[model samples]
Target: MKPELLAALNAERAARRACVVVTRLADGSQRLVREDELVREPMARDTLAAPLAEALRTGRSAAIEHEGEKLFLNVHAPPVKLVATGAVHISQAMQPMARELGLDMVVIDPRGAFATPERFPSVTLLAEWPDEALARMPLDRYTAFVALTHDPKIDDPALHAALRSACFYVGALGSRKTHAKRRERLAASGFAEADIDRIRAPIGLNIGAVSPAEIALSILGEIVAALRAERVAAKAALVP
Candidate 1:
């Protein structure tokens, strides 16, 4: 309700941070906990301190008692990180697909010709070799790596990098024979057979695609399937 507190809240929101507001209750208890980190308490300030402290510590919004009034607080969290590797023709098609799926996509390629905005207008383009480029790119739980380059020199290093990171999906574009060779190469490079299996090589579903665009569609479809499968597995793990 105070102008200074309101300004502070606005500033935090502008910085993209979650905040919780706390309000006190009349019975020296906390009353309302709102999603936007705003809490209202009718209790005294001192009575509200403990609940507010707990909410802040747990990064949650809670109601607390302040002089017997209830107050509420809001909490903010960072957005998810999403990045895509390999900026080939398939990538041009895949970028829009990813955007449609609400992913923050980025394109990485060593060839300037392939990594231009003209080719990938909706994605962040990084024209560096995957080994060097992925070194700087942030890969996390929500990140997905797709290797469409089809060249072992490019795809192998990128695949290796993706496997080493916490990325949720890692795939390589190739046919069955090509994927066999890829697995051999990775094994030769000291990766375990199990690690090599992490790649969804022959990358897409067996959808009988002949064109680049159709292939991209199949690949993205597989990615979505993999994501859904992971979600389902996670839920199953929590069911018990």
Candidate 2:
């Protein structure tokens, strides 16, 4: 890679932005493709849109034939992050699972008693208001946000942030009736019905989860499903 290209790639990596390095297999010529550039550059979109989208979404590098030219797409995507609003038992149970799944876990809660380092020794705990914590660390497309506090003051603000951003998965832990009430509140706050619908209320896979650990497993399972399903959607969109 040229010095300029390497610098650009490093900048993207530092900013946690998704990008791809397209290298021509024949001549060793290479060019950098920022995630936004794919949409703005018509020529890049026409030639490499589908594959580039797949590579970026899946965070996988691949070699492909495009219009008789063999090219390599090296995808650079930030690791997926899970940001939950509560540092409760369920969040504690999710720590190891999140680690094994290679997701960076962050818990934000204003209640210091629940957000103690003693409870979440291995996880990142932010004992600040959800809105304040999220302001410092913005949610992005690769992020999964969950409102586990069951407190509107804490969870609702986080939900607003997540729904406003491009979080891949947004869920809230509650009953159907609880979620219905929450939905009404969000609508009253001016969120669109489509935006409110993005939240998976009664969160987690329907696996009859009874324990905190079980619930954590179900939630992570659902998050993984959403993550991969999005890649599948990206691929499906390219089908002729």
Cα RMSD (Å) per model?
8.0, 3.3
Question: Against the true structure, what is each candidate's TM-score?
Answer: 0.65, 0.87
lDDT of 1 by residue, 139-220 (tens): 6555677887778877788888888887767887777999988888888889988787888877788899888889888878
lDDT of 2 at 137: 94
- The C-alpha lDDT values of all candidates are 0.69, 0.92
Off by over 4 Å in 2: 1-7, 41-46, 49-54, 57-60, 230-240
Q: Give residue 84's error in model 2 in angstroms.
A: 0.2
Query: What is candidate 2's lDDT per residue for 54-127, written digit by digit as tens?
Result: 88867889999999999999999978899999999999999999999999999998998898989998878899
lDDT score at residue 140, model 1, on the 0-100 scale = 56
Q: What is the lDDT of candidate 1?
A: 0.69
Model 2: ten consecutive residues of lowest lDDT: 38-47
Which residue runs of candidate 1 sit more than 4 Å off their true CA positions?
1-82, 230-240
- Which candidate leads in TM-score? 2
